[model samples]
Target: MALTTKGNLGPGRTEQSAFDAVHSAKRKDLWFAAGGLFVLAIAMSLLFTLIGDLIIRGTQYIDYDFMTSYPSRLPERAGILSAWVGSLLVMLVTAFLAVPVGIAAGLYLEEYARKGWFSDFIEINVSNLAGVPSIIYGLLALGMFVYGMGLGQTILVAGMTLALLILPIVIVSTREAVRSIPQIVKEGAYGIGADQWQVMWNYIIPAARPGIMTGAIVGLSRAIGETAPLITIGALTFIAFLPSPPVTGEFPFISFAWLHDGFTVLPIQMFNWVSRPQPEFHIAAAATGVVLIALTFSLNGIAIWIRYRLRKQHRN
Candidate 1:
């Protein structure tokens, strides 16, 4: 290579030469960027390949009937109607029980709990619980809720089991979100004569909403896919009947009977199909998998949209 001095180039060309020289000096960074791109490309390739295979194999079996019909022994006629509805009901109960309690626990731990040995012990356990296998939660729910409390293997039991499974995740997410709020923001609120409750409700919660929502969505997604815990709770895989609605034709007909009814969820249903020896059921399982993935992604998208809207409103 020929060496060139600044004087060798004209005024306009001199800065361009220096810029090129600086970039050329970092040959290692260029190689690193190329290597990172290659790895990402490989990962994306595997993902797309799996998705493509699933769609190709399952698309023929997907139809409106598949979404509305109950499971049948015949793969050609089988549908996930009972499975999807049961999953929805169970998740409703899970969210209802988990979100409020999780958020409250998080709030108390982060804001009100005294810094002491007991507090530290609770925090450590919460972190540890977040990593515990989902199956263990099932066994605990079985021992405590089913046989111990006599709730039996019902939709309510399944939902409560999942609630316990995801509670730590929600609490952790909530605390992290609250912790991110600038101390000055709280100080400013207090400076303006705001009380603790008002400061948290009006300022901290709103600011932390995005992170809290992200965590909740992730936790719910995990709960939705969980199979072992529900199985441990004795969720029947062959359920054909829908839980009775909370209300009927009569006046003041609301009821909680449905919560106590037997149920089956998407994961359990898919497991049943996959366990079958027939190849056709495999296709059905793939179709069910697609639907499950779509449901999860839809929830995540909704959460993201809500976060975006809230942040936009906050900026305004």
Candidate 2:
């Protein structure tokens, strides 16, 4: 059916048109992808611009006096001092509580625990726990530590609560990282007469370093930003004195009282300033926000760098 003089409905025409249609569609798809990227870039630029504005407008208020000044009884005079110290103290406590417990739990589940219904149930519950509102965990801490256990609402209790709040995230991340290791590494260690613990610490885990570090950073970052649970557990909104960074009894850092004491965090303090009637307080809040954001970025950066180094080490 080569076209008669009219060239109507020729097989060659059909083939040529179909090829042209497909080619045109592919070109359109490429353009669509490029357009999507352009939009995404614009959105990201807007976000950066907003952040820059916050820093510029806010940093005008940030100074050495701001860093060292304690919270004032008056909203107008208050600085982020107490909140900064409390956040530092409480976060250290949360880190101490969360890292070991989470890593251990992850290890037990991934490396040692037998595959069974109990394990499945625990896994399901942990996932569920991660999704639980952080405020609920704070309430749990309030009930158990402050009221039930008779510990005052202090930094220690608040830290413990936040620890539990973020524990599931840490555990899940750790487990995934550990699970990513090649089974062959474990087997190789076993063939060399190594014990389970030995293989885990020496071979399998090291092989999965990047995943584990990434997960740890993710979890830790989440813990750092938590406000709800710490609020519930009674992290102090303002402390008159800075707690020492470590426990030596000479300068007390640990919150011994849990029941009546209050605690504070960067976010909570930020909230306080932001809510105040004074524009000056809002300026202080923005400054504190910059510090908080910087802390989070620094931690993430360190973890990522560590992961990269470990990966390179393994490759070499």
Best by lDDT: 1
lDDT of 2 by residue, 1-316 (tens): 6647874444565687887787799999999999999999999999999789779877877778777878885755667777777777777777888878888898899889999999999999999999999899888888888899988877778778878887898899888888877778777789999999898888877887787667767777777788877777666666666654344455455644432346577888887778888887888888888888888899899888999899999988
Report lDDT (Cα) of residue 83, candidate 1: 94
Off by over 4 Å in 1: 1-25
For candidate 2, the per-residue lDDT at 72 reads 81
Worst 10 residues of 1 by lDDT: 5-14
What global local distance difference test value does model 1 have?
0.91
At residue 27, candidate 2 shows an lDDT of: 100
Poorest stretch of ten by lDDT in candidate 2: 252-261
lDDT of each: 0.91, 0.79
For residue 16, give model 2's deviation from the true position in Å: 5.6
